[model samples]
Target: MKIKSLITALAAGMVLSTTAVKAEGNAFRCAEGETYYMNVMVSGVEYWFPVYEMFKQAAHSMGCKTAYTGTPEYDVNKQIASFDQVLAKKPAGILVHPMNSDPFIEPINRAVESGVPVVTFAADSPNSKRISYVTSDNNREGAYAADVIAKALGGKGEYGILENPGQDNHDKRVAAFIARMAEKYPDIKLVARAASNQDPTKAYNAVLTMAQAHPDLGALFMPEANSALGAAQAAQELGGKIKVMNADVNGKILDMIKQGQVYGAINPNQGMQGYMGFMLLFLAAHPDLIDPMNDYKRASYNPMGLPVVDNGFAVVTKDNADDFYWDAYLKRRGTKGIEE
Candidate 1:
């Protein structure tokens, strides 16, 4: 009896120890040299800095490595070349903001086939085999902006939109904004449209022309921050009659908001986008960690594949404009914005 009790106790101890070891081994941690890269077009833009900072923080906490790589120019071909270069290094995973949607299909599919997971953020390649997309709902952003503008204009006025036509997110914002205005706020008319192409000079020229054509332009909207700089300048020139609003903010945009030169901005939750993007990429890269009761196993698909994830957004007005400054964020973080 004594021998049997001792044997039973030993067996229980062995089972418990084995289970503990397995749990500890399965805990999320990167192996040595594991690295992820974030690739984008117009890499020098301040908008990407906060996103990358959060991405890097999440990677470091998991003991993984990360890099920021992209073309300084907005050229798609150059961005693709940079992506290919990053791929050549065989990173553990990649998070990319494709300049154009369809153009990225082949590259993103190629990466997935090569066993390197790719996740897209902000702008997405929806037709690609990229594992997931992390971004705010551009349609909602535009609809919300329309409401803000219409209410500010007392539900009846003229507004013009500056566009970046070829980009997916920008196109969605413009389309949704127009549709919402026509559907719900018919009294507010869209008088003009022009492609800013994210150029301040083009935006300046476009707004000036629109204002000249429709002197009753009570508000102007753009889908991005860079164009807002010039649009706000033109609005200022028009004696601040046009309320300039946009979808993103930089230091200058925030300053303009505080000074009431720009009405407000729809700022996406960039940090959540980055942090959740890394998590999605990591899980996609390590699919063995999950075993769901789904068709993924039989279909030979990534069980972790997510079609889209909305990180949400915030409205930045003069009251909260101080909280959205990138310089202050970088200073608090004690790190170079995107230099490293």
Candidate 2:
């Protein structure tokens, strides 16, 4: 596969519409006298703030109100409770990142069954009756990490993984990385797999333990950027031997990549995920405006369409780390071509 772009319009903090949305045209009509509310619900609150920001940007562009509500802790129960609380308001639609697949089915279905559309983002509850799912190709992200790390190590080295085991998307990334390594780079052995649960401190301790046990460990791959805080610190303290690789990018992670403390990152187009997720929810909720055959009642697919949006990803390294920073994205967003 060819190298992905350094930063796409969506990754640059510019709200992008997947397909042309008739936000105000005669083809689309808002619910009369009803204040349409859109919200994003997630578990790892801090890590997803940028995504919520972009979600707000999308809501702003569409002339609607949006809110962010979720648990800071990585607790599924807390997220579920938060979901319930958000549902009580009877918002127009919801965009949620379900922590696990099985636990979210009932709540998502309940929301949909009640006429409030829900779109899952980043992480999905695939079997749930969600109108749509929006995210990057996580399996390919893992495969990308495996390719980069293997090439960095000259195709042979012992590597460890800092995994968020139970989460569906993170698990897919870890499994794909391991499988890609085993299938394509047989000599690059996976020495240790530690459960970090998306916490940096836990990842730090896990890396320290793995380094102590493996000694020959050449690299470490984590599923998300937050864990890089600890993993990068551990690698830095370990005389800079164990290279750190992971998915997602942010201000701090990009700095680590520039300083060579972290190897590289696979950056998903989070802005697209947020913006398009809201779009999906809006479109799903307003099926009255969308119809292949000219009416939601007669259309075979409008509200119940199970569309999965691939927002795409990019591999970030020191060479283009500057492109993925939050500040740079802000500047780019101010530019004419990419502004929301």
Candidate 3:
């Protein structure tokens, strides 16, 4: 019996030693004194900063470090500069939102070459060597908006497309919206298109201008939260005459819906995109779970698929606005209801 006990103890010690060795085998673990800064370069904060905030929090939860910074404007050069700055520190992974698709190719490639993992969100640089792009089905989102507007109108009338023009996701959304309108609802007329540049003030002015010019404009269609916010305010001022349907629901936008100003919004889970982007990078450092040689497993090589993950959205209307997401809305934007 004594000999048997000794053998069991020896076996347990061997197992523990092997487990320790396995744990120590990762060559890419962030050194004890090192930090894996996750650089998040997005277009602007006010519009989507909640997402970045959540990402930063998620990284902390996962025991990973991060840096969330972005240029206030949608300037590609500005975004590239942010990228360059983050790359200089040689971070563990990067979650970026390339304002311009074409300009980011070389910089993203440089990051990958330097052995840094990069993932993009909301938009993508498809031509770049980056591994993934995390965004929703933008084209589908546009198409969905088109269908909603058509059905709400019960056939057709003049409508306007609100977009940012050169942004890849906006371009795709507009194209899909128009295409769906042409194919499925041929009778619907997509009239004046306004480039709001994703700014609330610009969107407001644009919608007001278009509304004054095109008295017959039936509804406002948009894929951006800011544009939707502006359009809803305009339509509300005009007595909700034009049905406003759009994507990305913000706290203010939701209130408009409750008040019968904004008709509805396709709300995407921006938090999830950010949360996942950080995870991909954090996990990539874990060589045991992610194979370095496999391009699909690493964020650096798979950013093309990540920068635009289809973080889902749902339509919010007056009937369901109360039950929708008040708590999440308050938490994300750091605002409370008028009563609160």
Who wins the lDDT comparison?
Answer: 1
TM-score, every prediction? 0.93, 0.84, 0.78
Candidate 2 versus the native: TM-score?
0.84
Per-residue lDDT tens digits for candidate 2, residues 111-188, read 888888888888889888888899899999999999999999999989999988778899999999999999999999
Worst 10 residues of 3 by lDDT: 298-307
Q: What is the C-alpha lDDT of each candidate?
A: 0.93, 0.80, 0.72
Q: What lDDT tens digits, residue by residue, belong to model 3 across residues 55-91?
A: 7666655555666666665578877887798788768
* Clash count in backbone of candidate 2: 0
Full candidate order by lDDT, most accurate first: 1, 2, 3
**Number of clashing residue pairs, candidate 3:** 26
RMSD for all candidates, in order, please. Answer: 3.9, 10.0, 5.9
For candidate 1, write residues 49-86 as lDDT tens digits.
99999999898899999999999999999999999999
lDDT of 3 at 103: 87
For each candidate, how many residue pairs have backbone atoms clashing (under 3 Å)? 0, 0, 26
